[model samples]
Target: MPFTVYEHGAVAGWDVARPLRPGRSAGISLAGFRYRSAGSADLPVIPHPAVTVVVEFGDGSLVMGDASGWQQRGSLVAGLVPGAVRVRGENVTCVEVHVSPVVAHAVLGICPAELDRTVVALDDLWGRDAARLREQLGDAPSWEDRFTLTDALFSHRRGTGPPADPEVVRAWDRIIVSRGSVRVEDLAAEVGWSRRRLWSRFRSQVGLPPKRATTLVRFRHAAHRLTAGDSTARVAAECGYADQSHLHRETLAFTGVTPAALAADPGLAVDDIAWASTAPTETA
Candidate 1:
């Protein structure tokens, strides 16, 4: 079967559960064998930050590049950090993972310490030993299995620990639903905790203030629109920004690139790309 992007989670922060595509699904060329296919997309370049890992199976070769000097196509690439991504290729019978910081921590148990904004091969990690990873993707899977696979592939890095408080996660859900339009007090009240208590939980779990996470969610929402080629004004209005100017300023602040620039060339802005989808639970 062809690989498909699956959007998962109720929270506004995008999380995708994807499957390994069949060779025919994505046109892949490996060892002089040409496989013709087109891939899927999860999100667009956004003002919010994220990390992406591209994994290839068997002898499948991967090719990726953008307008900027950054480019790579390998058997495995892991360490691409938060950025705007313009990913397109054929024969990618592999998996693409995009992670929010909070979910990233929960799954990977750590963030990329050096902020690797380039593509590097991980063939050695899977070298001569892909069976473990293949088994992890086998039948009768559960949430724990998904979590475990994610942790195994990316959690060994440095700079983070286990998940934070459950209450903090609950608070994050509420904020995503509100799309950053709700008051902090409202979130605290919903969780039956004081504002300060809620903020503390958020900081501990997500490593950022509640307000910052909210901003990130809003930017993420706007980023989807931007990727779809929507105007900044449209994205801002749809995502509850104060105005187009508000969207522009906020995007520049978070991504260090203009919204226009991001939309025009997603491959360059490493921090604003959407790298995953919310599917796969159903396929399993």
Candidate 2:
């Protein structure tokens, strides 16, 4: 697939590129980014509902640090809801992949729960294969080629890796379709599984239990809406929050910032362009 490059002056000096076509799997999405000038950047890593994989190339360096002062550099993977982490780098260039937790287990070759909401070196997970991938991406002639290579790698992994349970996938899809408003009991009934069984399987396979997953999904939606300049009160009501205070509490808990600050965050400002069609939409 070809890439559509944009000079994104609005978002922290990033030159972004997204695939003309979506990845082969609905569970995976990719975007490429390059810094226009050689300089350092420290941007907050906002929590999202997917596992994030970043493959860094070029002469620049990429480092991810958490609130606890734990840090990892170079190509890395951050699990779902990686809390209070920041990405720092100089002239960074990389292909960022967001793998839906439903299929992250198969594509990443490990249970998402094992990631434990922390950033880790990709080499720690993929071993030497991670280094080879960075080399391949760097050697690629264009952003389009880089995206193609990434899609191929994930396609192969998902094909050969063990699959998440069918019931788990269904439940996750329903939560997404409902924009995280679906209750655990409803999901269990729809999937024909006991509540306890669903909770255990979901936590083990998707990394977060059903309730936590719902919170993440809902928070993700609310964050994007806030980023789009929605009013806190309206967003709260439309997104299933009890009130503006409820929205404020969840936003603060997830991002460590109030709704207004989160709305102005640079990390989320680029989502409309980079994620475009893949971001979930409200279901009727």
Candidate 3:
């Protein structure tokens, strides 16, 4: 895989790599990051629409924290809408996997609802397997090899794990395809489920209720547009918000930052390189 070196602004001195080929499973994406210098790095984590898994190796000093000053170190899993979090580390090297909620349960071996917008140690969910994966990745000779290992592990887990409900998957697909503009009633009708049933099932299976999920998807789309340097007014109008104020409220609720601030976020600035092939409304 080719690596893109970012030596300015937020991700200075970092080598970010993406897989040369696509992963075997749908809704799964991988990005590899290796910080060259031994100096510390601290960057905010913008909320996204996927389950984020960071498998760290070098120095094992990566730390993730939230607004309340709570922190966790080493490899970790952050579920959908993990609000106001930041990652800080020294000499960090990791393979970060973003799994769509539609398939996250199967790949992560736990329902996203269990994660519930919190960051937890990978070992808490994957036990010794997480540590072993870190060791294997650390020993890998190259980023491509590490990406291969990571993809293979997710594919294997997804194949053996229990699949999500077809109805839930359909609803999630609708949300993504419609850019979260689809109504819950319409999704329920399409799936031949009642709104109440779809709500319950979607929440249980996909972690967030349909309404919240819709907002997340929509917010993600608007966020990318903003990061691309689009004006707030244009982004709001194009992305289905009623107006700029609506966009502002949603952005503030999700990220605790105004649209202007989020537009300049270092975390989002690397999206084009790390997640180029993914849709703005899809996984991180």
> What TM-score, over all chains together, does every model reach?
0.53, 0.92, 0.91
lDDT for each residue of candidate 1 in 1-284, tens digit (9 for 90 to 100)? 23333333222222333233212211111111112333432223233333344454443345655456565655443332334444444543344555444554544444333334444554443453344553443331343344346445554432345654667767777776787777788888888889898887776555567887688778877766786788988898889888989988887765567889767653422222223332224333
Flag the better candidate by lDDT, 1 or 2: 2
TM-score for predicted model 2 compared with the true structure: 0.92
Each model's lDDT: 0.51, 0.82, 0.83
Tens-digit lDDT string for candidate 2 (1-284)? 23334332236677767775667877898988876665787777878788999999878888898677788999988889888778889979899999988888788887789887777788888887788788888788777678889998888777445788999999999988888999999999999999999999999889999999899889888888888889999899999999999999998888788999888878777655567655422111
What order do candidates take by TM-score, descending?
2, 3, 1
- How far out, in Å, is residue 231 in model 3? 0.5
In model 1, the Cα lDDT at residue 249 comes to 87
